[model samples]
Target chain A: METKIRQLSSNLDPRYFQIVVLSALLLYGVAILDFGIRWQNAIAIMLTAQFVQLVGTRAVQLPRFDPLSPLITSLSLTLLLRTDDVRLAILAACIAIGSKFVLRVRNKHIFNPANFALVSMMLLSDHAWVSSGQWGSAAIGAFALACLGFIVLTRAKRAETTLAFLGCYAALVFGRALWLGDPLGIPLHQLQNGALLIFAFFMISDPRTTPNTAAGRILFAALVTAVAGTIQFIYFQPNGPILALILCAPLVPVIDSLLKGRNYRWEQPKGVL
Target chain B: MRILATIAAAALTVAISATAQAFCGFYVAKADTSLFNKASQVVLVRDKDRTVITMANDFEGEVEDFAVVIPVPTKIEREQINVGDRAIVQHLDAYTSPRLVEYHDADPCMDYRHFEMSMDSAAPQAAVLEEARKVARSRGVTIEASYTVGEYDILILSANESSGLVSWLQDNDYKLPKGAERVVDSYLKQDMRFFVAKVNLKEQSKLGYQYLRPLQVAYESNKFMLPIRLGTLNADGKQELYVYALTRTGRVETTNYRTVKLPSNVNVPEFVEGEFADFYRAMFDKQVEAENERAVFLEYAWDMAWCDPCAADPLSAQELRELGVFWTGGRGGSKIAPMPAQDVFVTRLHVRYDGEHFPEDLMFQETGDRQNYQGRYVIQHPWKGEPSCDISQYQAQVRERQEQEAQQLANMTGWDIDDIRKKIPFPEGDAPVQEPWWKRIWG
Candidate 1:
């Protein structure tokens, strides 16, 4: 019993918090907010993700088959990816978990699994698209607050990425508003978008894909923010932040190499790295 | 040989009829925007960089005092601007309006088949529903072009500074809104020009049109957006704007704001047929509130060829061209058959916006999501006539369905549950025979 307690407290996994919060958000979106996620798509993603993860685990020859990470990736895919085809949904799940095994340098995945799958499917098919503005201000505000609180509650291990991304993105929005001589309300409204919130808290702050060091992570976050802003304002495109992340994903290894430090590990303490 | 050919012809006819019934439903009443006060309607047609915009004025105010300022992405030439027929827009509205489709039940005892008939819920026969003026250049403000279109004088103005434009408007007695200067300044910085129009009293009298037709302008630019900031500058609380977008693509949605589908295709109490407008308004209000009053709701998204339950007949090619659908390839003002549906897709978007709720101009994108959707409600009227067999089981099931519909109606419109139940006409001995506590306990 003492050994069990020690083991449990010794590795207080953040995945548990993430799972709870993300599930709550999914529930809120489906039941209360009426987000456009089909039940079949959700089930297809959930099963296909685990199946892909199992295949990937065997290929990589890993000792343990951890369902937690794949579950998180599958949930994120379900939340972000919108498609009518069950085949597309299954493909997205495969790409999401499969990327972690295939696309890597020095045992580190280059892209966030969910982000990679989203960008890949979007580039490939017309049916796959992201509803970035599906979350209204009411939900955005609630989501943003909840995400911030989640970060705080978790002690924000490797949270510099999320903080820097949100800060830089907010700055760019306000800066654009100021330059246009538009009202502050515009930037405030833009910043309170739920997609941006999800990107910052869940997708961007994923420990595996971000740079190792805090400084490297911050710099990476700022660059992603700048690219996203240009795509949105200059190119007049939707889902700017999402596409920006994919575009700047290859730079993660570069950032990690330049600011050389230990890589991120799950369920680790703040000072571990 | 003659008998065989005749039999083949009859079979083909039957096949066609069956398919028609499958794909089509009766268009009952329509729930148009006449239910809302101070509603404005706009029809936007965009392909690549070219856009043709039509603004319908339910102005109901003094024609002389009515003036509108819209921002254009590019400079408009005289030939690019024209006054559109208001009847075509009403036709488009009626065609795409949210409708009620009724499906009457047959005797439960007999084998049955279903049929559908569609009609406009509220045929807005009431609506058949623009002008331009001259301008002087000064203070870096250039009146690029000016002309009279129908009953109004139009001006295409490009200003270097917002204050110059604002002063010019004020000088001309345009009565610019209080915060229009800032928005104009922003648009000017973005390299946008102002398309200003005022009632041409002399032209109006000459034309003798008591009502203002829709003002239309075709321009080529990459910005597929609507300038609502200037309109939002008005401090008269939230404004209702309906956008009917006709495109070659699937659907049009706001990039900056959530384009949500309103509560649709739900069963309501049969009596709702009489008060559909009220039901629609309440349901819409509930949805808008639920979304925190910041979403643009999609009322209908359907192909221009046909409607399942048509609120109004689909617009022909001639009518579409009159509404500035230039790509329809029927420019000789000749009528085209409404068969084999047109390439045009229609997306009807409704937004209730205030400055606080909608801070930015609406940015729209054409998505490939061609899945047809509409704000439709249903009333499954139960068979009331005597059945050839016992109808006790049918009556029991009808009571259950009625209760469920009552609950659904209450949830959708936030109406009182008891009130909905009272409105619901349940069969005699309405309550489901719930097993008594004593019986259940013993069992």
Candidate 2:
């Protein structure tokens, strides 16, 4: 028994293995529920992409089992697709997954993967993103997002950034509704239909993309939230998340570099060997 | 042989030069003196490429592009001219840019003459035919044996046949060529295909007032101006009026009316006797009264009703119930109802009038219950003290019921609810209906 345990542990660390398994399950589960028969092609492409990223780059360094990528891709495919539009959904998922790596600056992705994919599809192709799944179904996705949030929060991912993003988005939507005398309920409902919750908890709260200092992260998230909200209200376009991320992503590196540069000196811990 | 060839080449050169001078450039001539003045400028320029004309002006800046320029006639210019004014120029141009064109005096042909004739003598049909034939013969027109409209004798005449008539009538001098027969034929065919049947000739007579008046008067009185003139005699001396109405289907409904006057006016020449004068006067008076009554009703109802004058029919108690009105019987042997009211009230009631009084149509009432007279309640006039206790309280109640019925109809469709609400008569002030969230999705 001891030998078996050792052998299992040596092959792949429990945490890393858990992450890979959970990610795979999440991707397949979302594809089946949201895409049904269409998920066959999507799963194939997603696995191929994941394998390539893991083997080719050797940069699979998630510390905790975070399901942000799978959740986002699933939510995007589910919310912004019709049953027959499998090819487009797969294309969108690929763009979203690939964007995290391709459209990165320095150490972090420049835009939210799902948001980047959605905007690129709209600009380049004739495909549209439509809502699916019942409003009640959001509870499940929200719970999963909360679990992911716990992992990210425990790993020093800033909570204030997520809060700021949510706060700014809510305020802008409410303010515009009041100004235009439109029904306020519609915009509020829209927040739950897209990959908004996942982005708020996991993508924006990414440690590398977020500021190290609490106040800096708060400012970054607030700016991103404000930009996204403004794009949605003013242009009434669906590129809000991408726009928000693009606008705020650069600030993270600048902020991190500033904080780290200022506090470079390290003191030895008393209990360390 | 070389000398002969050179002579031939010189002759060809001279012929080409003369042709170019004759056809290439725009011509400038006074409208009264111009040979082409009789033809429509639009027709003259039709299908002719690369042809442009400009009006002679003292102002020498960049002039805007225009389609055509019509010169106000010398008479109008003299009347409207200031001391330094050369001529009054009427600019007709393409919508994009103003391209000023040559100006000449107004063509006398554009001024239309109004004439009216009524045949009410014994054998009125025959009288109309006889009058038409006489007019055709006096004008030297050939009456085609096969060309007979129902109760109307039509004569086909070439410009030459009617040259004497043209000489007599100043406006008729601008005669179209024989080719214009096709234009007239095409217009008649299209017009006939799209014509709306006349509902009531009497009501139409009243409607004709605004049309027969002076162009400026008619333009001011009506919200929309029809492209065609009304109460005008054609070259055939037939009095016809055209009414254009926009239908619910978004197409124009044109109704034509032949002038029908009292028997005394049949023999008189329409232009001299002013046959359409009474028709105009009557129409204007009725229109004014109708407008005033509408304004008063609108003030009380707080909104305008979509009343179709042609659809206003009297109803009995049973018929009223079918129309969705709740009813009760009353003293003085009258029927009444408590009607559902809305924010707006529109009624298309058909009523028959006897002198100054309008009696209800008993057939619309429900039978069996003598006391209530088919579920209707009779009541005193709401505005009995008002000077025009003229309109019945029952009519008002009917209007309210009609509004409620319309509202219920709109609720079923889930679309145009607001518009339907606006059109109904509500006793209470404007209040929006609060639909439950679940019902919004399901219902």
Candidate 3:
């Protein structure tokens, strides 16, 4: 049964699985959890992201337009980016798709598309914010389970990044609590955040934007954790992981150059290292 | 269309009772901070990096026994600390409290144009100086500044270590709670200064004030948070904290913990109007339980210019400034002005927490969401006047509404449904006709 399931799964692109999982989470958030996400904004983001992806493909003269990448990005933005203005939502979609085509280093994107758009929208206007704490503990528990299933379905090809980032983040949070003489519940509550889970499993674990080597990815995770801990603990700011990711994006190419490994392609379905 | 007619009829009948009602509903009762024992109220007025914090001292004991040790982000100087008027804080509380409002259902028999009407409805510290500094310095503690503001003697202390600070406070007869040493050390490690205030009985007696006024501090820092860890050190099982944030942009919410908006705009049984305080406490306890006791609840978030029901006309510009809203122009505007103030948004957050559930300080961020919200429960009085036409359907609908309200009350407050049903008068007669179970199942 396992062999047959793997055989069936190997034929499909992992992006399809990610898309399904993200859509399911988005549905749960909207319908059951009352995440206060506007349907019009979600629709606008989906359409705008796909349209921008099409335009970028035509401009770059690619063989064909693949809607999966933009669809995943749109679902991510719909799940994370919050704004009262529909125009801002459209702008987020445009920036997310447009960055993939424009910002390149060594034929690879510098930053994760959704991370770039979320951080940019936050800096651009006060209207947009990420409701990191909107997901209660029960929702976080369910989402963590879904993320674990996602790693299984994808065959753990790029699971190293998520694991390394989560491990380092938990260490830092717990370490801080220990030093402060606080109870274990403090760090546990911090780790149970849905936004943090999404960042680890979706944003930071994006193989396309991460380093091409395992050693490089681990080093990258450490750096992001250091910066995130500073922002959260020292400066007492919200959206630490997102802000840290954008800040650390420029260093990925440097890591790629130093470590020297084969680049990842979603269709390859091979080991990351 | 039929539902609309029934609602109109309910409203018309409500007019016969001759009690005032408004768009939000007629003001009945409120669940203010006083509802809970050991409830602490803090007002934060913030814009950009500037923050003015007024800590209300609800310390219920001898003035000499009242002492507060708060962890502040920046060092506070003598000029930065002031004694605030207690009345302003009370006014702010009344303005942002969760309110219960009632509406009258109109007569189903009479045809009247639907209309709207509205009506307006409605701590101490002491300490000593100089020689105390000598004792503090011996304990590796630096007394940043000291001031006698009104009836309170305030001190700003920065310590090299938590043990030294705790010991220094203890030596000075400041009665530090157990497990506070570690918390102080943590704050010191994080580069936070301590604001300590105690009542000066000599000065307090000279001032002839019966109660201790709130202590206000103005500073510039990026950390927008309330230090609740030390408060949790007390033996109290749980502490209630109400934080009223006055900001320029929009609603303020917690970053680390989920900020859930209290259930609002809900229709409830009319009996709730009399026991609003009990109803609110029960509903809040249930909400806290529902969120696993780790959530901060938003009770009210609205523009300070006006209110739909005008709980107590918006605070005047003078009152706003007294609470440290520095950007509201200059001087007092006309007291008779219809609109009292603007450009200030107030957000009321209530948190019932303890050390076990909340380990870290309460951190906040001001969002651009200007959407207005309030903890408003509605009680629509059923029309009791005689009807000129056949009104069995109206009565049936009213009965259904009453049952739904009872269920809603039960669900929200975790009250027994039977007890709720007992409390509700429930429109008389026109019981919902029950279909035969066998025929229905067969069909």
Candidate 4:
């Protein structure tokens, strides 16, 4: 198992694999599902994200330019965000890469870059929205998780947050179904959403933004899940996970303060493709 | 050849090229709700927590035997219920229906000027549909309120248990659908109340009405959803439903299910103009199959102020008020006003659902998306008249367009390409690319 892990993580950053997966999904959505993502908007977002990344690199006085992070952020923004205006797409990309440089806690950004941009754009303008149902409930769901599992398994030390979040979220969902006397299919269908899977395996599992200790990460995941369920079932809003991640983001610093564990750096062992 | 564009077509083209209009469609014959057997129509007017729902069923049976028990989010009073005009509902259907548009090949010798044509929906009078119900007081089921609205007796009932509601309904001769007990229990657990309505023969006679009008109820709740599980409980096959949402802010969509836009803006053969209804039905079935029978098809989404072809003149202001456009005015009905300047946005959704395919009820969310859309199928009429100038090039374009239309129709409705071609009157060998026999041997 260790040899297999070494083979997977030896040569590349995991962000590159994420970029590949998200790009393939975006292409699939555009070509097959007709997801209504305008190519002009996509290009504007891509160019603007890299531009912001370059500006951030120079402003922060970093030694080298890192295109992988911006590329990942741009791909994710394209996959999740839906809009007609080219300007909104560019604004969203700028917000995404820009927040990573501005919003920090203990040298760690508070929110996942893509999650921050999605929520900010949704709250700021009516022109931009997230279509959670865009990914649809299909067999592609399991395939998505399988590909996502590579990043989780390769970064075993950080997989706790993702696993805990999915476990707690699934438990609450099934519990609600049982309480409501709903068919099992309902929760199963909810679980199969490609957006939810992406949230579990990618956005929520961002190591830098998570609690440092395993216990703290699990607690944070559970808390976020509960809050998200309230937003969805009680308040009757869409994209509960995206909103919940932001609402719970500030607690990560507090969790690290209390738990006192190792800090994360991408270059340190876990960030391989 | 000197090709002079028609005055109307030229103006329309200039307008289209100038404005980049979000949506355009010609008014044509619509496949109205009446086309589907046992289909139900619902108009949902919502803003914030407030909602007004109008339900109309095409029930073809004895009036005394028609009864329905609906789970409402809150208890409604007598003033909350009203009998609405069926013409308005029919008009809404006409306004948002998938339409057929045709353009005559503008004297091919002259510049072909293609323009849009549209028609208005005429309101139809409400007709009688029947429901069966009786009264038997029970301990667990409490009738909180009772009133007479139009030709129907209305009652608001709150129940403590599903079995209590079921027994109360059965004891009263309501003839509730089999397996409704589970759904009733579920609704009760959610703290929902039941609204029951049945025809009153004496009221029908005194009101001098032959048909049952649509019933409207207004209430305030955070839940923007439709409970359809009960409707599917007794169905032997799939049941068709049409939901027309009128909102002050923007469009409403099914949150739990995928809302897919129906195939639109495609051209078919000119023969489709004659059988537009059949073409729509076949295309709808094809779409339903393609989505694996699990999606809600968005038939139309447009601003209430105006339509491209003005399908039914965007509903008069008074008509809008009657359909439960609460913000049109204070109660919103005084005089007939012009349209496309109003604040209301309408979204029409259609679904063919059964318990097996659609296990959960439809939950809706109103989005601030005011982008306009409509299902429009076009047909380009060929110029049968002889061309006076260098119009041979235009004729070739027409032939190619006609062949493409044949393939499109085949693709949309899954009809055989050969069969579709058989119906199309192609211009000589222009479509099939025929050549002389000598060319096959020597060239």
Candidate 5:
């Protein structure tokens, strides 16, 4: 019985776990937190993403079609993106999946699909925005726990990006507090935000889009954090990390070329790929 | 795309307490904001980067003792400062305040029709000059600009350090609150300038105004936020703030903290009309607690063109222009299209905050959502005259509704359920009556 359980855990891909967790969070948000996500829009995003992914697979002639990636993207987009028009939601789904095929370098997508779609939608239409404070601080504790569990479940593979990003971000916030002579409570309150957590844990920490080497990932994390801090404090804008990730995505391939390392694949075991 | 932002009907809570007859029902009393002590009101008109802010205070003390220090995002010159009319702010309060409405039930034996009636309810000294200047200069404080605008003397100050600013304020007889040094230092590091105002008694007498009017300032910056940190430095237990945000787009909400809509459109007992002020206070207290006292409550968000059951008439273009809405064509400026041309969206946000839960200042962002939301509560009056035919079913349903209203009131206000039920005048006939439990067993 123990060996059978071990076999299931060992052979199962981490994306399945990600899909379950993201879906669960989505359920919690829509059901309990009043995220204000419309049901029709959620359906359109999911279906449009899947349809685009299928067409992209056929056009590229990949070995096998995988629906999990698009499902994950759809869930992330629904969780982050807000718009009154269903057509815009559908358009966002198409752009998200389409970017994975068109914007590739060294056989890896440069930007996280959801991040690309969100930025594109914001630039393309004025009706779309990200409600960063919708998740309120009351749910931060439970959310942090879920994210920590996710890190443990993934065996900490490429977890350096999440750690480094959060560490650098916290240092910058606290440093600002000290410089301003403000109370510690101010920065503490700022840090306890759900949107920032979502960005740190799920969006920026995508192993496929991050650098291949551990050292390269840390460097990339610092770069993104610096840009994000500038945008938020200097420019006085919201969703700094989200906008920063898209701006910094193109540098991943450059970093990978400079510091040579093995590429990441979901199916392959460590040291084999 | 012309997006019509209409809120869910279920969430329709309108708060118009002023005595105005509009909509389908007769207007009644409203929840007066005077129930809150230490309350401050601010009107912000924002478009892109240019912002005009009007700060109003109800200082009920000797006019000579009134003074205020506000942190501004940019340097203000004389043209950027203006004294606003107090009546306009009062009118805005009446226009956007959460309202109570009454719906009289039609005769069940006769033709049935719904009826609703809407009703609405509605600083400091200064210091010396040349000797103060040397001290201020030594303390790294720069009096950037000084102007006398309509019964008040205003000084714009920039400081190199917080200590200098604090000492300068103290030397000038402005009592600095404890722990204000830290807050002042924080603002200085951010490169924010201070707008200091004190009543000019001679100018006040010349202007023939008894009470102090609000202070207005206009500046251009990317920061769409209010500095409440310095206000929190005082030992006041809690402060109530009403922010009336006028924007060109849809609604404006706090980006840093959660902005939750206040409960609206719920039916309550008939007695709520008398003590709506109390009911509003209790309901607001309950909501603040529910959100853990860390949220900004959105009381009203509507287009300025018109209102269905308006608490008061929408502000005219002339009035809106006075409140710093620069988009509208001003007096004699080719009076163009009348209604849609006044593209001003007003959002009313109320918060009871202190230094603890609300550690940081409020940060806001304008969204594309144009949904009109209001904090409106409803009450229904039962038929009083003699019925022409049998109305047994109607009375039973009315009793059930009364019970529901009782439970809802108790749930929202944390009031005792039995006490609420005792107050409710439940229907007399055809209502279910409780029987002794012993009868069921013994009989």
Candidate 6:
């Protein structure tokens, strides 16, 4: 019995456990809130997309951790779709997820999944993410709280990135609101109604696209947040995150090199060296 | 001379139409008899036919010195003219020496007339008629009557008279064609009304009485607080009322209320169905005899539920929680089913509008002993002497009571009742307040 128990526990991979737990939380959270197999089907599409990526690449190398892709894509899908039509939702989900894998360069996804998917959906159909559930103040508040908790529990894995994002976003929004002579109350209300919380805590902290050094990550995050906020304010498009990320993503290597203060070097085989 | 003037005027009119494509210019003439002298003031006119020339006194010439000059050898063309073409001409003095000038074609007056006429005559009429027909078709009404007067073609369709046909017409891309006028004429030529009654008796002693058919009740106790009803009421019991209530989010509720009075004779109409005729005759005689008794009230209710709160606050995070109101869930550790409270209320009143008060002292009793008491009742007339009760007075009383209740609720809730009231207004008021900040943000 003791041996059997040990074998069973040992068989459970830690990474698999992480995936299962996170997926379950996401699925059940939506289900408890009246979303059911519809959302699950969306997740299934995401998984299938991941498998497609694995197959298409034909290389066993795993991609770097991306914080915002899943959250953004899930939130966007939830907001835009009215019916639980599995096929349509899955189709959207696949496009949203697959875009991240296929449209990447230098080991980092170029665009924010949530931003790209939302903007693409808007341009294609009349679907609008602005009117999605995640845009609800209370729901956004809850998501922010959850993200904060996750960040804390994860030992502030991307604390610098988060800080930079929120700081820059606040500055941009405040400056614009003041310049427009809008009552301060209205912009604050608008801030609470958008995906600001999600972008700050999740999208900006994406490890692959963000810089490695603490200061670099902070600067990168701040720059992206500011640019995104400005674009959203001026153009009134929904792809602010993707635009900001794409603009800043290329800088990750430069920022890394600057922080390291050394030319990148590759290791050679011992005998050859 | 009059005839000559008329002929000149007619020729001028035609020339105006034809020369409408001439280049606009201002004529300048010298003030003195010197031919070489340059004119000071100028006249500005369109190059097109019938150019509206504005003369400026700044010209140095007296009226006579400014002999109306025209290019003496001007060439006019009748070729199919395109938009932008110029006229080439030569002018000569009495000395017969020619000078050349160029005049570009200007927009034609007939083009403007054509556009205006199209807008006024065909475009608007077609658009308005098409839209009206579309709306009528949507409402399942057949266009059975039509009349044309001048530029207007009025169409009458089979429709529920009291429904918002005019507003619907205006809202749904419907507009009066330009030049077509609408008139209000008394066109409806029918009076269809009916009344049904029932009664109960206790061992030959008269007990109670009730009026049937024209029943007034709440239809949709949510969203829009409006009262509705079936058709008019007469003594005949063959009339039926169809009631429909819809939410802003597209949820619909439908109910059919029907009543029938029986025939006094054994013989039935040849056109009537046998089952219906027999049922009507038996029901009528039985109801008459039972008029010396009491009355009964029956109510039936059903609901159609939609999972989406699209009609409510679309941007609300509570959309997720809204499903809890319809599905089974746990609340405070106890299992519960979804039960959304009716937020909009609709009442369909089928009572008499003929200025008569119903008897208040009447009691209710069943018509038959069956589980479903399908019968009628009759009672003593309440307003025996008073021929009519003023409808306006009753309306005023109801309005006063509603205002009082609203005021009371406002006081209790400590909410801005006035603000809430602004969001929804009575028919007499202007449009409803737009969705608020939170609603717009979330939605």
Per-residue lDDT over B297-332 for candidate 1, one digit per residue giving the tens place of the 0 to 100 score = 998899988877766667777677767787887544
What TM-score against the true fold does each predicted structure earn?
A: 0.82, 0.31, 0.88, 0.86, 0.88, 0.33
The TM-score obtained by chain A of candidate 2 when compared with the true chain A: 0.61
> Per-residue lDDT of A230-262 in model 6, one digit per residue for the tens?
665444334465567767766777777778753
lDDT, candidate 2, B1-443, per-residue tens:
00000000000001011000010011122223222111011101001011111111221111111001111101111111111101101001001010111111123222222111111111101111222332334444332221222221222232232243233222322333232233223222222111101112233243332111100000011111121111111111211111111111111110110011111101111111122333222322343233221110000001111211111112222222222222222122222432322221111111111111111000110001111000011111122233454443444454444444444433322335465556433333332253244643553
Q: Local error of candidate 1 at A251, Å?
A: 2.4
Candidate 3 per-residue C-alpha lDDT over A181-263 given as tens digits, one digit per residue, 9 for 90 to 100: 77787788788788788888888988888898777888999999999999988887899999999999999999988877554
Maximum-DockQ candidate: 5
Ten residues in sequence with the least summed lDDT for candidate 3 chain B: B1-10
How does residue A186 of candidate 2 score in lDDT?
A: 35
Compare candidates 1 and 5 on lDDT and give the better one. Answer: 5
**Which residue runs of candidate 5 sit more than 4 Å off their true CA positions?**
A1-6, A139-149, A152-156, A261-273, B1-37, B107-137, B332-341, B429-443
Over B166-236, each residue of candidate 4 has an lDDT whose tens digit, in order, gives 77766664444445667778778876778777677887787676556677888888888887777666554
Give per-residue lDDT, candidate 3, residue B395: 73
Candidate 6 lDDT score at position A144: 49
All candidates: DockQ: 0.50, 0.01, 0.64, 0.49, 0.75, 0.02
Best-to-worst ranking by DockQ: 5, 3, 1, 4, 6, 2
Interface RMSD for candidates 1 onward, in order: 1.6, 28.5, 1.5, 1.9, 1.0, 23.8
A26-144: candidate 4 lDDT, tens digit per residue: 78789888867889988998999999999999999989999888888888888888876788899999999999999997798999998999999988977788777766676555566
Off by over 4 Å in 1: A1-10, A60-66, A139-145, A152-156, A261-273, B1-37, B106-137, B201-208, B324-336, B382-407, B415-443
Rank by TM-score (best first): 5, 3, 4, 1, 6, 2
| Candidate 4 structure lDDT | 0.72
Candidate 2: TM-score? Answer: 0.31
C-alpha displacement of B405 in model 3, angstroms? Answer: 1.3
